[model samples]
Target: MWFRLDLRTLDNPALWEASQNGPVIPIFIWSPNEEDIMPGAASRWWLHHSLEKLGAKLRELGGKLILRSGKSLQNLKSLAKNTGARAVYWNRRYEPLIQKRDDKIEDELKKIGLEVKVFKANLLAEPSEVENKSGLPFKVFTPFWKQCLKQLNTEKPLQPPINFEKRELEPESCNLSELNLKPNHNWAQGLEQEWNPGESNAHLNLKLFINEALKKYTEARNFPDCLGTSRLSPYLRFGEISPKQIWHAIEESGEENWKESQYLTEIGWREFGYHLLYHFPHTISEPLRPAFNRFEWTDNSDHLRAWQQGQTGYPLVDAGMRELWATGWMHNRVRMVVASFLVKHLLIDWRHGAEWFWDTLVDADLASNTQGWQWTAGCGADAAPYFRIFNPVTQSKKFDPAGSYIHRWVPELRGLKPPYLFEPWNAIDIELSAAGIRLGQNYPYPIVDHSKARIRALKAYEKIKK
Candidate 1:
């Protein structure tokens, strides 16, 4: 069995089915060509550790995870031939390039008389199964998610199968370090401290969420100060935990309100993202709404750099960006705030934020990243209205009421109180002095006037509006 995205032994369709037949050979091929969607630095760090833990688990179960670096097809063909393997099984991935590659590989393997089976282990519902009444793929999430919720069989998730024995004919493997997945620089310390990427941790996190956070998720999820949102995103993105497992877990938790809960709706959004990506693959690079193609983007490197480095001069935006830099993750509401500031406030392209997140985010799924940026920019299918610009100060005040998130990330403003905590530059001389904030020095002044930037963004949208 080949493990692509699905990393866990629990609720893994490909692994469970293959083990049922007979002894299974588990192999991972690191294809250089996958660099297009290859994990960004933060994700690579998580993948490195996730693969390590997975290998250990397999070994504990009396099997070895053979790793190789080469063209995936060639490696698969070579390994199958050497091992006398008749069949290959793995979970499905939804990335356009990955799907194309997998399809060709499957066809070629089948031609050579190898039985290839790919199962849906990533998403709760496959995009093909959840469609509009007209048999068309959903462009709007409300109807799309409603369609999914109607079809959800949340009672039985695939059981976690027993461990399997290793095959006699084992292939030569390379060390994990040989893949060079970890960054060369000493930049991973923060990410290392923040996350534990493995199946065990995934389960633990889910349990913790259900125990502590689920009940308060609706109100507290928006508050970056609280651990209100499930941090299961990275695990889910890497397939360390299956959505089915999460679905059934919610059901079994006796949380009667889960069906109507905001947490479940968040899960639905993930399903919606995959549904969009599968049906309209080109949105990865282009705007889904064609009108956005003509939208003028300033492409200001300086402004973009400021945003990236957390020197954007906007306290809340800077804090969010800094948090992302320090840890591979950022709060969801903060993510939207930073994304909006990039596309609307700075007049930079949404693709810039998408690409940066692709590199920096540990939980960076291509579908979600693409959808989020496009949504923030009002360039995607069923996107947020472009006219509704987010005021970072108000958002910061509302969400991180005590300014702890900003204080934690932007330590320079830690001593500052509310209102000024959200917007330091607006504070009076005595307040700025008492807080030890120096405009354009310790703390940056506002990058762009919020009022001016909002108008600029709306005017840009006007071109595409007509």
Candidate 2:
């Protein structure tokens, strides 16, 4: 079984099927260049640990996971010939680059007389599963998700395989450490503190969410300070846990109304992301709505740098970016706020921010990442209007009402109070003195005034509204 993103043994169709057929050799090929966006530093860190855990699990199952680093096709062909393997099996990835490469590899392997099969494991449904009466993909999420609900399979995941014949031939393998996934410098302390990568932990996370947060997910999800979210993105991204597992688990969790559950709707959004990426492959780098291609974006490196480093001067935006830098993940509500600020307030190209996130986020799935940035920039299917700019201050006030999320991340404002926490620039001198915040010195002043920036963004959008 060639494992790319699907890391877990449970509910892994490929692994289960391969085990029943006889000797199964689990091989993981690390070919960075083959991917359109090479796994970023943060993602690589997570992958290293995820692979480690998977290898340990396979050992317990009485088999070894072969590790290789280089071109996937060449490595797979070489390994197949060396081990006399008869079949190749894997779960599919939706990214255009990967889909193209996987297709070629399957054809070549078939030519060499190997039975190749790819299973649908990551997503609840395939990208091509549902469409309108016209046979065109749905651009709007409401109609899209509604259609998806009708086609979803409720079957339970396969029980994890306990035994498989281990390949007798000594398949040449590289040390996982030699893959060089982890950074040389020790900069991942926060990520280490926050996440535990493995299938067991993935299931545990789901259990914890159901116990503590699932009941209040709708109400408290908007408040970044609250632990209302599952924080399962990295697990889901790496396929340590399958969507079917999550979908089934949530169904049994007994929500007030399953169809209207906000959390499940978020999962639907992920499906929508794959739908867009699969149907409109070019949107990975270009705008989905062609008019957005002509939209002018600022090339201000200084502003971009400030946003990247969490020095944006807006409390909510700064907090979210810093949270991401430290933990390799940020609250979902804060994600929209920070993204909106970048595309609207700063007028910087969304791609720059997406690239930074691609390198930084452990949960950065290609379909979701591309869809999110383009959606924020009003350049993708079912995009928010470009004129509907997010006011960082107003968002901070509304969501982080008590300023807890801001203080947790932007510590300089820990001593400040509500109204001032949202807009430090307007704080009285005495209040500012008590908080020990010198706006221009310690905390940054607002990079762009909200009222003025909103107007500027609106005018810019007007140039493309036609």
Candidate 3:
């Protein structure tokens, strides 16, 4: 069984099918050359631990996971020759480059008299399976999701294979350290403290969310201070947990009309992201709407650096960026606010923000990252309107009424209360002194004036509309 993202044994169609055929030889190949965008530092840190956990799980089941590096096809061929394996089975990945690479690998493997079987395990519905009445991929999310709901797979997820067998002589496998997946620097301490990546933990997290947060997910999710959202994105991205597992768990949650719940809609949004990526692959680097290609963007390294370091002087935006740096994740509501501030307030290209998030977020997925940046920048399918710029201070006050979220991240402003905390620059000199804040020294002043920036952004949008 060739494992890529689908790390878990449970509910893994490829692993199940491979086990039924013969003795399974589980292998994970680390071939960064096959990727368009290599996994970032944070993602590699997570992968290192996840692979270790997967190896342990396989050992417990009386099997071993072979680790290899270099070209995927070459490694697979070498292993097939060594083991005399007749077939290769693996789960599918939807990134444009990966899809192309997999197709070529399948063809090469077949030429050598090996059976290649690929199964859909990551996404709830395959991108090719759903389409509009015209038989083309849907551009808008509502109609696309509505179509998906009608043909949603309601089958129970497959259980882990029980009749597992292994070859008498195991092929030589490299050590996990040789893959060099972990960061060279000591920057992963925060990620290690925040996450435990493995199949078992994924299920435990799901259970915890269902018991503690699901009931209030709709309202409480907006507030970063509250544990309202399921912290399951990284798990899903690494394929430690499958959408089918989450779907089945929700169905058995005893909630009436669970299918229409807001939480499920978020899952639908993930599906929508992949749908857009598959149909409009160019959106990864270019805008989906042609007119957005002409949108004016500023080239200011100072402003970009300020936004990245969480030194933008807007408390909410700063807090969100800091939170992402510290935990390798950020709240969904704050993500939109900060992304808008980058593309609109700072007038930087959305691609800049996308690249930064791609490097920083542990849940950094190409499709989701591309879709979100485009949405916030108003340049992709079902994008937010360009005129609707986010005011960081107002968003901070609304979502974090008590300023708890800001206080947790940006501690310099923690001493001040509500109104002043949201915008420290507006606070009186005495208030600033009391809070131990020096505008340009400790806490930064607002990078861009909200009113002027919003007007400037609107005028820029008009240029594109014309």
Candidate 4:
């Protein structure tokens, strides 16, 4: 069995059910080209550690996660030939490029007289299964989520199977360093400290969240400074945690409180993203709303660099970006604001920001990144209206509130007052000097004027309306 995102054995439908039929052969392909699609260096480092943990877990179960390099199809064919394996099984992938590649491989494997099976392991509901009354895929999230909830009432999550027949194979596994990713890069120290990526850690985190944090998730999720939201996105993205297990865990909690409802809504949002991905394949590259494609985007590399480095001079936006760069994760609220600044304030292409997130975020999944960036750019289904631009200063004051998150990521501003935390440029000479802050030296001036950029973006978008 070949594993893509479905990394864990527990609650993994494809792995569990496949093991029941015959001896299971787990495989993971480490392809450099594919890795380049997203998560350039930092993500690769995380993958290296994740695969290590998964391999260790599989070994304990009398199996091994076979690591290989090169094109997935070529590698699978070679493995099948060496071991005389009869079947190739894997979870499905929905991105534009991956879907095409998988389809080609499926055809080639079938032609070579091997049975190939694809399982729905990534999402809660198969994207194709949820459709509107008219038999068309939904572009809006509300209707899509409602349909997902309806389907969940019909079918629930599957547990990990413990009864797979152990298969023995001496297939060659590649060493981690053979993948030739940029070595000597240790920029992800904070990410390593913040996240433990593997099946055991994922499962433990889920149990803890269900037991403790979930109840307060409803209120805490909105506040960036609070640890209210389930920090399970990276695990979910990597398939270390299954959505079915999460679904069942929440149900088993049995409190049925409003917080549970809110938490489930977030899961629904995850489904909504996959549903959009399935329906609109082109959304991976193209805009969901075609008119937005005509909007003029400034090719301001300096501003983009500032945003990426978290030096945008807007505390909230800078903090979020810095957090992502440092820890490969950021709060959901700040994600929205920083994304808004890129697309609406800087007037850069949303794809640019999305690509950066793809490279940096541990939680970066194709569907979520696509949905989020498109939503911010007003180019996605159920996106905010094109006119709504987030004011970064106000957003910082609202979400961070006490400047705790800002100070944590932006230590240079630790001693600044709460009022000026959002806008240090407003500090007078004495106050600025007292705080040891200099506008352009200690911290950046706001790269783009929010009010001015808002009007420019609106005008630029207006040109596309006609």
What lDDT does each candidate get? 0.88, 0.91, 0.93, 0.83
- lDDT, ranked from best to worst: 3, 2, 1, 4
The number of clashing residue pairs in each candidate reads: 0, 0, 0, 3
* RMSD to the hidden true structure, all candidates: 1.3, 1.1, 0.9, 2.1
* Cα lDDT for residue 85, candidate 1: 85
User: lDDT tens string, model 1, 129-165?
Assistant: 9978899999998898888988976646666555564
In model 4, the clashing pairs are 1-25, 11-160, 39-358
Name the candidate that leads on lDDT: 3
Error of 3 at 435 (Å): 0.8
Instruction: Report the poorest 10 consecutive residues by lDDT, candidate 2.
Output: 161-170
Per-residue lDDT of model 2, residues 1-466, tens digit only: 9998999999999999988887788999999999988889999999999999999999988888999998898998998888888999999998989999999999999999999999999888798878987999999999999988998886899888765655455689989999999987767888899899999999999999988999998898889999989999999999999989998888889877866789889999999999999999998889998888888899999999999999988999999999999999998889999999999999999999899999999998899999999999998889988878888888988899999999999999998999989999999999999999998999999899899999989888889887
Candidate 2 vs 3: which has more lDDT:
3
lDDT of 3 at 309: 97
Model 3 accuracy (lDDT, Cα): 0.93
* Residue runs of model 4 more than 4 Å from their true location after superposition: 32-39, 153-169, 180-183, 257-260
Write one digit per residue (lDDT tens) for candidate 3, span 333-355. 99999999999999999999999
Which candidate leads in TM-score?
3
Q: Give model 1's TM-score versus the native structure.
A: 0.98
TM-score of each: 0.98, 0.98, 0.99, 0.95
Candidate 3: stretches off by over 4 Å: 163-165
Pick by TM-score: 3 or 4, better one:
3
